[model samples]
Target chain A: MMVTGKKHEAAAAPSGAKLDLSHVSKVFRGGQGVHDISLSLEPEMIHGLIGANGSGKSTLLSLIAGQRFADSGLITYGGDHVNEHAAALSQICLVKTYERSWENYSLKEIFKFASIFYPHWDEQLASELMDKFQLKGSKNYQQLSRGGQSMTGIIKGLASRAPLTLLDEPVIGLDASMREIFYRTLLEDYSNNPRTFVVTTHLIEEAENLFERMVYIKRGRVAFQGPVEDFAANAVYASGPATVLEKLLGDVRVLHSERLGGKLLLALEDLSGPAERRMLQDQGVELSPVPLQKLFVYLTLRDAENSQGGGNR
Target chain B: MSYRSLMKFHLKDYRRGALILLSIFVCVDTALVLLMKFLPAWDMGTADNIFSINRNIMSIFMIISMIVTVAITFPLMSSFSVTRRNFYVSSLLALLAFCITAALAETAVYLIGRAVLPSIGLPVDVDRPILLSAYVFMLTLLDVSVATFLIGACYYRFKVITGTLLAIVYFGAVSLISQMFPSMEYMENFALFSSDPAMLEPGTTLLAWGIIALCAGAGWLIYRRTDIRM
Candidate 1:
């Protein structure tokens, strides 16, 4: 149905998005989900929502989708509170990991059903996806394999082409080839449409290059967020003997360390000068670039370690 | 969310589930009918008055359908997005469909019985007007009431198996307590149709439906706030 005082196409096929999630803490009665979190996402970019299990990544996503409400704050999308954006849920395609079966309905039926709310829903894309995915109309949903079922869900979210697309672990079950297909299709689609795609996953390394910005969620809060390259560049790894490395790096930040025989692999932060490099070299230290994955690991883990260590650093 | 659209889409799902369920219903009902016709040893202690016997047979089929519909609805409820704003509204619609479907299925049996029975004034005990409207309302009541706890419990708690078991255990336990307390006997009033399927008085019918609507609204509010972790 056409919403009041809004253009039909503009409402559905929104070019840019403004997503604001304020002090949104989801506290279960039993103390389980998200806690005191706040985030504002920029539009027309691939924003990665990453966190370890129980860090409230999924809870935050649910709040954005209005599948679950925040106990204490607001989730505003396109200048409207999420609940008020009931009209927008149709335009926001949420691909949940555990959602199984649209209940034996044909692939066509599934698209048709969802298409009611999404005025900008690409029917051609839906048909193309079914062909690309090779999903048969006659087969029951339960008859498909685990990967196949996931593919169907992925198709729904992608084909819906919602302006604010949230994909929560969409490629977990698929093989490398299928994941590549997903990534390529996602990039291609985003380029063509220029819509906001918020993807939450543990597989950061695979798509690190694709990310424009990253939201590293640690304990339901943004521990670190910036451009993916900048995020990876924030921490660098250097190596040498444990004592020499410690002395050379004295008060500087070190996210992780391991002594291989007599050599220490030290994940370093705040590189300064040639003198510092020489000092580390004289100590037989070797510096290496920390991959985005390692940077993520260090950022997430080091924060927890510091939170526990009483800020002695 | 567009409830009408969601409902239409859901009914598509319901068709598959319904077909499987109806196949089970038809096969069982058809088998029972065939058994009554051909199988002498399988007969219940049914009286020989053809009209009365046919009505009783139809009653047996209606009760079976009611049980099956209730049993599977729990699973469908569990699979749905129970923590959303759509939960209660969807539940009400599902219940409405369930009740209407059951009543219609039951009505079919009544018609069949009327056709098969010996010469009697209109064959079946159902009043056309009463069966038509009252079934819609009664189905609404049964569905919304049962859905209140079912939808709430399923969304808040994980595991469909555990959720269903818990709902049954809780219902049975609460029902027993209500039996013991005089003031709590009102809990049983919703099930008045089950006790006497001979339609309802207008006041009680309105009261039952009003309670269902109130419960449904309350359930919707609860669902919105409830944390959907899964």
Candidate 2:
């Protein structure tokens, strides 16, 4: 399915500037980075870039934002090469956990710099966010607590209102309440302005509700990319008697399986249609939808097992 | 327009640091000149006059300012989506502005000292304050360009320790070469301390400009391809 997003008024490109990455690869000296990634982000939608630690999510975001050039293939936004076109770059903002040189600058100063570069920067929203986050503009960045720093990055990402905003681990040090505030603020802003936001976080369940679509990267390759509901729909957990489940799921791709006191639970991928689920249910087997976090874990775990020359049952 | 904004941003980055350095320069120079005038028995050595002292101080200040500005502003600018080409151009402009401002301020101080010291029964040796300031501007510009290139190249490619060691080795080799070849001593003197306008050779000025261009070009080559890390 083609990912489509809402039109952004302040975007430099024409209304339908979907972010396109084709055959993209970035290999580091240590041989760990994204590989052969081809994906298109629909405009004006909140996308969850979910991945395990060192799964190349950050690298992919950097490549998209044009902060780092790709070693091969192409990344384009609005029909322009993002890395080579200033206008395309101006419309994208990638907010990291910490800006290395921002420590010495006051939050106000940082905002001023952002306002200068980002054509659609919302100063009023930035001020409101500062108040909401309980961050003083006069406070230098280094003086802020870790949560405060995270809040600062959040404010910048939300207020810049760029056409394509990528936030990497945006809620790293935030408390539960602040994280909720961040989510709400992000949703509210998107409601009002309607731009694309790609957020990468480990707090999958907490942020799952906010993502319209999800892209999961495992071992530097895209494992899944679709609507959140579809991602959940792609797999299911079936529980039944160990012997019966083993016999029934012999031909299926079982991502994970565990036996507990004569009962066996298996994560099964590509279990086609309602007939298969009904068949399992008729056989005294219980079928339940797998949660997103669990699905991610099971998927990655399967990849790990496969790579290690082991079968996934 | 982006270039202009970047230039303004860089100038702002250097403003506070430059002010602090200027204040220190003024305070120390003022205290020493006053002591020389008040205490006749305290011999102000021939090479230890206020002008010479201020020149050395300004050079140090400019070097520090250049290194700090590049180190701090490059990442900051990159974070704001400023292009590498714009950043390099704006940085050079800001550094040039700083050099000119410092040169003018140093000239004013020299003029004031020249006027006051004679009335206070102290002999002033320096002349042609305007020419001196122009030379100072050129020299400071060259120094800062070189410093900016070295700092940027080091941070982007070589780590700090390796860059520092490389710098030390290069300077050490130059020092050894100068010591071995007495004729090359003039070039060292021309580069470092050509205070007298009459001794300022056109070739020296041209060489300084050429070196500045080389540094700027080499710096851009390194910077344009550099990936802005975090």
Considering summed lDDT, which 10 consecutive residues are worst modelled in model 1 chain A? A1-10
* Top DockQ model: 2
Quote the chain B TM-score of every prediction.
0.56, 0.81
Q: What is the TM-score of each candidate against the true structure?
A: 0.76, 0.89
Q: What TM-score describes the B chain of model 2?
A: 0.81
- Residue B229's lDDT in candidate 1: 43
Give me the runs in candidate 2 sitting further than 4 Å from their true place: A1-15, A247-252, A258-260, A273-275, A301-313, B37-41, B45-48, B119-121, B160-198
What C-alpha lDDT, on a 0 to 100 scale, does residue B70 get in candidate 1? 32
Residues B28-140, candidate 1: write the lDDT tens digits: 55565566566656544322122223223333433343333333332333222222555446655765666566556655654565466324222233334436334533443
lDDT, candidate 1, A45-147, per-residue tens: 8998888776778778877877666778888878777662556555566777765435545556656665655556666666777787777866666677777
Q: Please give, for residues A1-313, the per-residue lDDT of candidate 2 as tens digits.
A: 1112322334233334699999999999887899999999998899999987788999999888877878898999988988747788888888988887898999989998897888777777788899989999899999999899999889888878787889999999999999999999999888777888999998888999999998999778887899999987857788998877987556546878888899999888867688877888888888888888888777777677665786533
Best by TM-score: 2
Instruction: Evaluate residue A213 in candidate 1 and report its C-alpha lDDT on the 0 to 100 scale.
Output: 90
Compare the candidates by lDDT and give the number of the best one: 2
